[model samples]
Target: MLTLIELVGIFFFAVSGSLMAARRGFDMLGSAFLGGVTGLGGGVVRDLILNQSPATFAHPVYFLPPVLAALCVYAFTPAVQKLHRLVQIFDAAGLGLFCMTGTMKALENDVNPVTAVLLGVITGVGGGMLRDVISNVTPDLFNPRDVYALPAILGATATAFAWHFDVLNIAVGTGIAGLTFVLRLASIRFGWSVPLAAGHWHRQPNIPNHGDGPRRNF
Candidate 1:
């Protein structure tokens, strides 16, 4: 079940990446590359930080989902275009699952709970960050448009709490993921946003505020 969750999460992340690629008028190769990066980048970073082989490299089967996602987007462009608005939802789901997987892996490695939570949030958002960077867009992780990291933080905290209580089973993990997913979607649905920096730091007279420009989807 955990393996299945990871695959599904990877697929969700791949969908977001491929969809973004398609939106940017990228070709098949671009779509495939971005999809694979979004699907496996986070876990690879987590593994590397933990001084282990990336799971995607060790289990080549994990490559299938991202490839499949790219193909789907390539072949079904029109359908995908219509559902593009759901990209955030797809990302949210992946964020939830990845956080759980990361936290569990960290705990398995006997990391302290705080480190586990930090790693969990990193695993949740790292792939998306890489995707945005590669695509030359601002990462959603830093976007002030919505409550992004909060959900992952909450989810990771929940997972750590569960682990502390020795009840970190499949059901609890799934529930925590679901909670994160719902929180993310709800934030989007309600146009929820976190407070931006509050100081009246003055920009240079000639310096333009990019924040006032059109908001680009990451």
Candidate 2:
């Protein structure tokens, strides 16, 4: 069940990644590259910080969903276009799932609760950060105009707290994930936003941060 949950998270992120790549007018190579980066980038960073081998290096299956998602988008542009509308949900799902999984893993590895929560947030959002950076655009993460990291941090905090208190399990994690997911989608539906500093605060109207994922354009 754990492995399946992780794979579901990977697949959701892959869909968002590939959909973003297609919308970017990228070719197959670009689609695949971005897809993979978005799919596993967070876990890669998490593993690195934990001083463990990247699961991507040992589990090639992790790469499959991104490539497959890219191919599907490339071959079925119109159909994929329809699917793109759900990209926000996909991103939210991935963010929530990874936050849960990352926190659990960190706790299992003996990381302290506070630091584990931080790692969980990083593991959940790092891929989207990499994706935007590679695309040569500022990510919503740094954009104070966005509200992504909040849900992730909340979920991670919940997960870490549960673990430290000996109550962390699939149920707790799932609830936290759901909390993150709902909050993110609500932010999108309700135009929830955080204020940025003056002069440095410019909203990137083109791409709203769908919670640690790419927008329709960048």
Candidate 3:
């Protein structure tokens, strides 16, 4: 289930990246390159942290899907535009699924709870981060107003906790994945975010007199 979800996510992200590349008037090779990176970048990072070769490199079929997705997007731009909401839904689903999968994989490798959560967050956000870096934009996850990375953190943490408590058997893991999926989708629909102080600042205290020489104060 997790593998299938990741594949679905990869296809949509690849298509989205390819469309963006097309908008930039890139040639076929450029489009394929962008699509492939957007699709597989997260998995590659997860594998490297786990001290293993990337699954995409070992299984060449991993490359085919993204390339094909790019071609389809290039050939059917208008149709894709018409289904933009559907694409967003797929992307959200993929995000949740990948977070869960990364957490599970980390646990299987005997990673501690904190490391599992970190890996899960990395797996969830790494591809999009790479995509934004390639596109020369600041990542949306870093924006205080965006709801991207929070959902992944919430999902990953939940999975780690479940594993730690031995509450996530195969059936329970599926449920946890479902829970993460719902949380992410709700965040999308509701524009959820961590509360922040808007237009507020705290003044720093001055340091006491040190000596005859002038001193710097924090």
Candidate 4:
């Protein structure tokens, strides 16, 4: 079940990545690269933190699905564009599944609850972050106006808490995943955002390049 869910999530994320790449006028190779990174980057980070081989490297299918998804997206651009809403729906599903799966893997590795929850959020958002970075865009999660990380955090927390209560077995885990999906979708629909003060901003303590002038924007 876990493997199946992971594959489904990878496929959808790959499709979304492909779409984004196409929208940006990337070549086929660039689209494929984006798809692969969006599908596997998060899993790679999760595995590394857990001191395990990255799943995409360990499992051949894990690597192929994203490539295949990119090819399909390229071949069916019109169809994919027409089904943008469906793509978003699947993306939300992938986010929820990845969060739960990451949490479960952390638990299997005997990680503490806090670490597991954090890992779950990382696994859910890391791929998209990689995608954005590669595309030279600010990651959506870093944009306080975006609803990228909150759903994953909430879902991971619920999973960890439920496990502690011995309530989130397989069925309950699925429920939590579903709830996370719904919450993410609703956030998109409602434009939910983290609270931020209009005049309050935090500045970095250290500057990476002294030759560069002081940063003006917060």
Candidate 5:
């Protein structure tokens, strides 16, 4: 059950990474590198923190999907970039699956519910962050306060709560992941977003203008 979810996530994430590379005009090698990192990086971090072997390292077959995804993108070229919406859908799927899997694994290792949810969020966003960093862009989840991480965290927390109550079987996990996926897709379709913080640099001070001052033109 665990490997099944992980494989689905790996495939989705790999495709997302390849699509990004395609959009950015990266070469075959670059696309492969990005795909591999995006597909495996988060799971590797989660496994190491849990004191277990990374799936990609332990099962060599786990590495094949990303490589295949990258090659497909490279072969398709600009045509693949035309279907940009497909990328977003797949990315959401990846986020949902990865977050749940991460949370479940953490709980299996006897981690507290809070920590498990945190790990879930990490697994959900970590790959995209690494992908953006390598591609010379700010991570979208943090810089702009996107709805990405929030949905993942919400789903993870729900799953954790269920697990705490001893009701978190594979079915419940899948449902939680599905909820996250739907929310993510809805966010994209409806232009939903989290409000940005009022940074000091962006705040405008209210200054009183005396009658002596000329009124500003609209």
Candidate 6:
């Protein structure tokens, strides 16, 4: 069950990366690379932190999804580009699934609940961060106007809570992940967002006259 969930998440993430590469006019090799990184980077980071071998290396089949995703994007670039809404939906699904899987894996490894939730959020957002950085775009996580990380945090926290109470199972996990996915989509659809930097909200107090001449924007 866990493996299946992870693979589905990977495929969705790979599709998102492939779409980005296609939008940027990347060649086949670049598309494949971006897709692979977006699909597997987060899990690799999680495994390394847990002192386990990365699953993408351990299971050769894990490499197939990104390659397949890239090929599909390359073949149908126009159609795929026109389906931007669908891509966002898949990305949200990937975000929810990865966070749930990451939390479950951490708990399975005997990690504390708090750490598990943290790892879950990392697993949810890390791949997208790497993809954005490599593609020279701003990461969604760092985009103050996006609610990307909040859904993942909620999903991870729910997973950890369920696990702690000995009530986590495939069904409950799926429901929680679905809720997370919905939250993400709703945020995008409704323009829901976290507040921007504190400075953006609150004005700095005026400096005293003893300060240098006219106060300038910092």
Better of 1 and 3 by TM-score: 1
Q: Please list all clashing residue pairs in model 4, or write none if there are none.
A: none
> 202 in model 4: Cα distance from truth in Å?
9.3
Q: Pairs clashing in candidate 1?
A: none
Q: Which of the two candidates, 2 or 5, achieves a greater lDDT against the reference?
A: 5
Per-residue accuracy of model 4 over 1-218 as CA lDDT, tens digit each = 78887888788778877777876778899898998898888889999999998988877999887888788978878653555465456567778888988888898789999999999999988888887788787787788876889999999999889878878777898898899999989987888988765534664456576778767754
lDDT of 2 at 5: 73
How do the residues 34-150 of candidate 5 rate in per-residue lDDT, one tens digit apiece? 888888888998888888888789898888879988877767655754756766777898899999989988998999989999998888888877887887776768666357888
Q: Report the number of backbone clashes for model 1.
A: 0
Clashing residue pairs in candidate 3 are none
Best model number under lDDT: 6
Arrange candidates, best TM-score first: 6, 1, 5, 4, 2, 3
Candidate 2 lDDT by residue in tens digits, 36-151: 89879999899999999997899887888888878877776665556545667778999999888888888889998888999999988988888778767678578755688888
Q: Judge candidate 3 at residue 19 and give its lDDT.
A: 65
The RMSD (Cα, Å) of candidate 4 is 5.6
How far out, in Å, is residue 46 in model 5? 1.4
Candidate 2 residue 89 C-alpha distance from true site, Å: 2.0
Number of clashes in model 2? 0
- 10 residues in a row with least lDDT, candidate 1: 199-208
Residue-wise lDDT of candidate 3 within 77-170, one digit each (tens)? 7653544454445455656767888898889899988999999888878877776678776665776656788778888898898888888776
Q: What is the lDDT of residue 24 in candidate 3?
A: 59
* Cα lDDT over the full model 4: 0.83
Instruction: Tell me which of candidates 3 and 6 scores higher on lDDT.
Output: 6
State TM-scores per candidate.
Answer: 0.87, 0.82, 0.76, 0.83, 0.85, 0.89
Of the two candidates 4 and 6, the one with more favorable TM-score, higher being better, is 6
Candidate 5: 10-residue stretch with minimal lDDT: 75-84
In angstroms, give how far residue 132 of model 1 lies from its true place. Answer: 1.4
Clashing pairs in 6: none
